[model samples]
Target: MQDLRTVLSSDTIIIGDGAIGTMLQSRGLVAGTMPEAWNSERPEDMLAVHRAYLEAGANYLTTNTFGANRIRMREGGLGSDVAGTVERAVALARQVAEGQAWVAGSVGPTGRLMQPLGDLSLAEAEDVYAEQIEALIAAGVDLIVVETHHDVEEAGAAVRMARQLGNLPVFASFAFNPRGRTMMGLKAADAAVAMEALGVSAVGANCGDGPEAVAKALEQMHGATDLPLLARSNAGIPQLGKDAVTLWDIEAAAMAQHAQRFVSLGARIVGGCCGTGPSHVAAIRAALL
Candidate 1:
C-alpha cells in the first residue's frame, strides 16, 4: 500500500474503518472490559474486525489499541506491557491489511484530565503518550491517529509525542458536543486551527452526536486550515435497548447521506464511529462513489 502521505497527496478520498468497539461488542466483548486486552486474548476476533472493514472499503485500518497506553492499561488492571499490547494490536491490523491499506496506530486520550482540572500534568501526559507512541513506531505502523479527544491539550500531547518519535503522518481529531464545541467548550474551528499549529497532517471531528454534528464541525474546520479533514461520526444518538444493550438511531443509508456532504465540505477521510458496523462502512464507500 502507498504511504498515508502519498495517499493524502493524491485526490483519493480515504475511508477509515468503522467502530472497533461496536464490532467487538457484537462478537461478545463484555462491557467494561478493556478492549485492548483482546489484542492478546482474542487475536482472531480482532483480525476479523479488520478484515470486515477492509472488505467494506476502508483505506485506513485502525488498530485496536485506542486505550493501550500505560496509565489506562494499569488503571484497568490490564498489566504494564503497553508495548506488548500495542505491538499485538498493530500486528493484527497488519495481518489483515496485507499491504492493501495503511495501519494507523490509534492513540486515544488518557482518561485523566490535565492539571488545574485533574491531577495529571502536561509533562506527565506526554510521558504517558510517549510510551504508547514508542511502541507504535517500533511496531511499524504507517501513521499515528490521536482521536476522540475532548481536550486539545491532551490530544496535543499525543500529537507532539508522535511527531517527536518519528516522521509518520499524525492525524488529530476531536469529539464534539451537539453545540459544535468540544466537551471542554473548545470550538471546532479553534480545535482545528490549534491542531494545525501542532503540525498534524489532518484535523477534524469524530464520535459526536451523529453525521449532522460532525458535518457542522467539518464545515467550521474547512475554513480554518489547509489540512485534510476527517469526519467519523457515530451512527446516531445512543439509545437504550433491552438487556442493557446500546443502539444507535441512524441507519446506514442515513449516515451515508451525510458522508456525501462531508466530502463536499472538504473532508478527505470519512467513516462511522460508535454503534457503526461493516454495513455502515460499505454504505459510506458506496456514498463516496
Candidate 2:
C-alpha cells in the first residue's frame, strides 16, 4: 500500500471513522468514564470499534487517545501513565488497521482556557500538548488529528506542537455553532484561516449542528484557504434523552447526503462525529464512491 502522506496529499478523498467515544459508550463504557482509559483496560472493545469502522469501509482510523493529554490524564487518575496509555492505544488501532488503513493519533483539547481568555499560558498549553504529541509520534501514528477544539489558540497549540516534534501530516478541526461560528465566536472562514496559518494539512469543522451546518461552514472555509478541507459533521441536532441528556436521531442516509455536499464543495476528508456509527460511515463511503 502507498504511504499515508502520499494518499492524503493525493486527489483521492479520504473517509475518517466516526464517533469512537459514543461507540465505546454503546459497547458498555459508562458515561463520564474517560474513554482513553480503555486503551489499557478494555482494548478488546476498542479494537472492536476500529474493526467496525474498517469493515464499514473507512480508510483512516483515529486512535482512542482523544483525551490522553497530561492534564486530562492526571485528572482521570492516569497521570503518570500517559506515555504507556498512548502507546497502547496506537498499537491497538494499528493492530486492527494493519497496513490497510492509516492510524490518526487523536488529540483533543487540554480542558483549560488559554491566557487572556482565562488562565493557562500559551507556553504551558504547548507543553501540555507536546507531551501527548510526542507519545503519538513515537507510537507510530500516520498523522496527528487535533479535533474538537472550540478555541483557536488551543488547537493551534496542538498543531504547532506536532510540527515541532515531527514532520507528520496534521489535521486541525473546530466545533462550530449553527451560525457557523465557534464557541469563541470565530466564523468558519476565520477558523480556517487560523488553522492554515499554523501549517496544517487540512482545516475545517466537526461535531457541530450536523451536516448542513458543517457544509455551510466548510463552504466558507473553502473560499478562505487553499488547503484541503475536512468535513466531519455530527449526525444531527440533539434531542432530549434519558437523564436530561441529548441524543442524535439522524439516520445513515441523511448524513450521507451531506457527505456528498461536502465532496461537491471540494472537501478532501469526510465522515461523521457524535451519534454516528459504522453504518453512517458505510453510507458516507458509498456516497463518495
Candidate 3:
C-alpha cells in the first residue's frame, strides 16, 4: 500500500520479514511441502505469520508466492493456477498488512534452467515471469521482488517483465555462493549492473550461506552501481543435520554483528533468508537504527 521506492530512497531503512518457509514449518508445515499452499489451505495460519513480522517491526512483508508460478507450483502439486495462487497469497498478506506496512510480491527463480544450458529459452522464461508477475500486479502488490535468482538472463527477464507488466517497482537480489559469485557465474557487482540496466529499482544479495558471506557479496556489489542495495542473508551458516539436510542456527543476536556491517556498507534493506523469523528481523531492525 505504501511506496517502497520513496521510503527506501529516503533516510529510512526498510526491514523485510524473515523466512516464510521456516516459519510455516514451525506452524505444522511438513518437510518437502510447498509453503505457498497455506495461502488457500491455511489462510489464517499464513496471516499469523504476517502479523508476527509486523508486530516485530518489519516495514515490508513478502507474500508467500515465491513458487506460485505455473511450472513450479505444478511440480510441488500446489496447482497450476498461478493467478489464483498469487492473488490469494497477496490477499493474505494484505489482510495482515492493513495499510500499516508494504507488501512485496516474492518471485524466485523457476526451478528450470534457461536454454543453451537447460530446455527453457529466454523468451519462454519471459512468458512464465510475465504470467506470475502480472498476477502480482493485478492483485495490488506494493512492489515486486525477484530474489535468489542465479541466472543473469533469467533475472533480467523477470525485472524487465515486472517493469513492462506493472507500474510497481521491482528489486532483484541474487543468491551467491561463498566465493561471492552466483550459481550462474555472475558476480555480485555484475548482477547489480545487469539488473540496474534492466531498470530494477534496487539490487543486492540474498539466501547466501550466512550473514558473513552476504556482507561480502554486498560489498562486491558496491562501486559498480549507485542503486539502493538489499541483503537478506541466512540466519547463520547452514549446518548439516542428522537428516543430512542443511539447517540454520543464527540467533537474533547472531545477526547483530553483520546487520551493523551491512548498514555501514550502504544496504538500504536488511532482513533474513532461510532459518530466520520475527526475532531475527527484530534484531536486524533494531541494529539498523
Candidate 4:
C-alpha cells in the first residue's frame, strides 16, 4: 500500500469513514461496551461497518481500535486482550476494504488527561500509545490516525509513537465544541500548529460540533498550518427525541455544503462524524467530487 502522505499528495480528495462508536451504539450497542472486543467476538458485524463506509464512497476506513489501548481496555475488563483486539480490528478492516479502500489504524486518547492536569505522565501516555501502535503496525495497516483527542499532550504522544513504530503516515485530529475550542481549551489554530510541529502528515478536526462549527475551525486551522487538513464533522446538531437522538436529512445536505467550504479552505480530506451514516458520506462524496 502507498503511504498516506504520498497518496494524498497525488489525489485531489480523500473520503474518510464516518463515526463508528456512536454508529454502533445506535445499533443496540450499550454504552461502555468494549467495541474492539467485537472485532474478535463478532467479526462479521465489524466487517459490515467497514463495508458500509466503503460502499458509501469512503476512500479510507478507520479500524475499530480507537479505544483498544491497554489502559482503556482495562476499564472494560479486556486489558489483557488489547493486543489481540487491535490486531483483529486492523485485520477485519483490511478484509472488508479488500483493496478497495485504505485501512487507517485508529488510535484515540486513554480517556485520561496528561500530566499537570491529571495523573497520567507524558511517559506513561507514550507507553500506552506505543502498545497500540505496535499491534497496528504488525497488522500492516496503510496508515494511522490519532483522532477525537482533546489534550494536545496525548495527541503528540500518539504522533510520536506512530513515527517511531513504522514508516506509515500519521494524521492527528482533535475534537472541539460549538465554541471552536477543545475540551482542554486548545483553539483550532493551536491544535493545528501543535500537530504539525510534531511532524504529523495531516491535522484537522473531527467528532465535534456540526458542519458549521467544524468548518469555522477548519478555516482557523488552514491559516495556522500548511499541512494537509482533514475535517469530519457530525451530520448536524443532534436532536434528542423522546426515545432516541436523530438528525434530519436536511442536515446531510447542509454538511455537504460545509464540506465544499472546507475544500475551499484547503481541506484535502472530508467526511461525517456522529449522527452521520452512509447517506451523509454519500452527500460529501458527491459535493467534494
Alpha carbon lDDT at 206, candidate 4:
90
Top of the candidates by TM-score: 1
**Which digits, one per residue and each the tens of the lDDT, describe model 1 over residues 248-287?**
8888898898899999999999988989888999999999
lDDT of 3 by residue, 219-241 (tens): 88888899888989988776788
The runs of at least 3 residues in candidate 4 whose Cα sits more than 4 Å from the true structure, single-residue gaps closed, are: 1-3, 244-250
lDDT of candidate 2 over 9-105, digit per residue (tens): 7889899999999899888888788998888889999999999999999998999999898888888777667788899999999999989898999
lDDT score for candidate 2 against the true structure = 0.88
* Per-prediction TM-score: 0.98, 0.96, 0.96, 0.94
Query: Once model 4 is optimally superposed onto the true structure by TM-score, how far is the C-alpha of residue 78 displaced, in angstroms?
Result: 2.1
Q: Say which candidate scores most in lDDT.
A: 1
Off by over 4 Å in 2: 242-246
Please give the lDDT score for candidate 4: 0.85
Order of the predicted models by lDDT, top scorer first: 1, 2, 3, 4
Query: Which residue pairs come into collision in candidate 2?
Result: none
Q: Which whole-number lDDT from 0 to 100 does residue 240 have in model 2?
A: 76
Off by over 4 Å in 1: none
